[model samples]
Target: MLKLELPAKYEALRQRVRAFVDELLIPIENASTAGTDLKPEIRARLEDEAKKRDLWMLHVPPEFGGQAGDMFSKIVIWQELGRSIAIPPRRWAVFGPDPGPILYQLAEHQREKYLWPVLRGEKKVAFAQTEPGAGADPAGMSTTAVRDGDHYVINGRKRFIGFGDEADFIQVVALTDPAKRARGGISSFLVDTDTPGFRVVRQLETMMIDRPVELEFVNVRVPAENLIGREGDGFRLAQSWITEGRLARHGARGAGVIERCLELGVAYANERTTFGSKLADRQSIQFMLVDMYQHLYQLRLMLYDTARRFDAGEDIRTESYLCKYFGDESAFHAADRCMQIHGAIGLTTDYPIETFWKQARSFVITEGPTEVMKMVVARKVFEDFTKTA
Candidate 1:
């Protein structure tokens, strides 16, 4: 048996985070945070508030000066934070440092050099995996890492990497063996951004607020010691990072979008009048609200159930894929309906609906798109059911 309901403590934590977002985040979302990043002074104040509220470093481990929260608790925080567009969809670092999950896999020395600096906010890092020719398919990666006497000479081009230009170092994934590719040929390395041949080519602007970058690594020699885990561990490690990301970033955040959209849609429907009646009284408007509510409820259930099973030390990778596609589609559809319900205001920046709409739409395409996710799930479906038949 699995538990889907959040425990008492987690429920209480959710309410606290919800209050923090409602009081501090939502109030300043439109005014204080217009861009992808919060202003310096505003970020300082919010970090101070987060510390006071015990919301600081909720994801990092306790030994690393963080609260060391479980997946479920972290999801609770993520879902509530999603309620406000004030927190940028791409960058959610208000509470504390976000060193990312990959760093936690680092060895002791690697942690001292990379992970610790990141947790202490002394350094910033970015993951470089998506190549121009291999956005969704890692097996088609053209980037190659050739092992030399004591270093690996990397030659590759990566695109759509967030914070690539600003990062002090990067977690780079490359093909070490063309024959193995994503199987056993791939490897991940911690490369200093200033390494001789590493360059930030340019930043690509998107409809979304995030401006991801393109990078080139030509004969960039990284010390063999910088290799994360074993040589062939790159694909496995990247999958681990992505699985959790799909859970928290897509699954939990999408829930936040649905919850917020439902709130906005219902309020507007009840308040706005057209002709001789409130929009809430009309069946069409009511149906939209109902759909939003339905998506919210279903997403929350999937998110909670997946998080619960994940916390139990079970392999929930497939479930994470389900959460990714379903959450992305459901959230996008909910945003669409919310915008439709808002009439013209939804298209304007007056409400957060437009922001939600654009960001939610992007989720369906990025981070293993809906089609790829469905393909993975379809493989599992055939494997599990066809064998039984």
Candidate 2:
């Protein structure tokens, strides 16, 4: 039988993280810096506080000098951190590094130089897989990395790279063996931003605060040692890493949004009124609260169940898609309805409901679009059908 209740140890950890998010972080969130990160001084102080409270690096493993908590622990941390915009503690000091799976495939010597720094928060990196023409399909990438003696000469453009401007280097996914393409033909190379031919061409303006950018590479030379995983394994490495991201970022994040929306909506319903009675007294308003709560409840169950299975080494890729698809829709619709219940005040920046609404909608498209999510689930369904047939 599977354990449904969090152990005392996990519960204690959860409470600590919840206190940090609610008492410490939420207060800071109301400031002008709300949704933006905390101020430098405040961030340092809070990070120090988190470290002292033994609430840091829950996502990392003991091998990396981290708590090396189980996948469920990491999911719990993400759920809490997802409550706010300032997440992963920037330095990954509190949440551990999100360096792509390929980094873990690096040779020990190469890891010492590239991987350790990221884990230590001394550096940041971006994965360059999508091009102007290759948004969903990695096989269609036109970027090429031709080997020239000791280095691979990379020539390509990567679009919509989040935080690319600030990244120390980019893991450029390039075609090393065109004949194979997605079939063990693509490769990933960590190209330094300071390289002569590598540059951030421009930062693409976005509705969200963070500005993703386009990176241009004109014959950028990447050292042989910088190759991550093996040559012609780029697509495989990318798919492996993106699976975790879809679950953690999109799936877990959607549930967290519901949690926040419920907090705001319920509070408003209890305190605010149009006439002589509280909004909570109105059946319509109460129904909205119930619906949002229901979504949160269901999403939380799905997320936790999925996290538990994942930790137990079960294949949960299909479930990950389902969780994200359902979670995104539930959270977005709930937030939209809550905003409608709040009247005009909800439209203002003073209220987080509008932000939640906007972000929730965007969440559907990120990681994988809603359509793609359904496609993945369908693929799984048909695979099972064929097996039985």
After superposing candidate 2, which stretches have Cα over 4 Å from the reference? Answer: 1-4, 32-37, 86-100, 386-389
User: Which prediction has the highest lDDT against the true structure?
Assistant: 1
Point out where model 1 deviates above 4 Å. Answer: 1-5, 387-389
TM-score of each: 0.97, 0.91
Q: Write the per-residue lDDT of candidate 2 for residues 132-169, one digit (tens) a residue.
A: 88876668999999999989999888898877888898
lDDT of 1 at 43: 87
lDDT of each residue in 1-389, candidate 1, tens digit only: 12345789888888889999999989887776645588778888999999999888987878778885568877898899888888777788888889877899899989999998898889999999999999888778999999999999999999999999989999999999999888899999999998999999998989888999999999999999999999988999889888888988998999899989988998999899999999999998998888878777888888889888898999998999999999899989989999999999989999999989999999998889999999999999988889552
CA lDDT, candidate 2, residue 339: 92
Q: What is the lDDT of residue 192 in candidate 1?
A: 98
lDDT agreement with native, every candidate: 0.89, 0.76
**Every model's Cα RMSD, please?**
2.1, 3.0
- How well does candidate 2 match the true structure in TM-score terms? 0.91
In model 1, the number of clashes is: 0
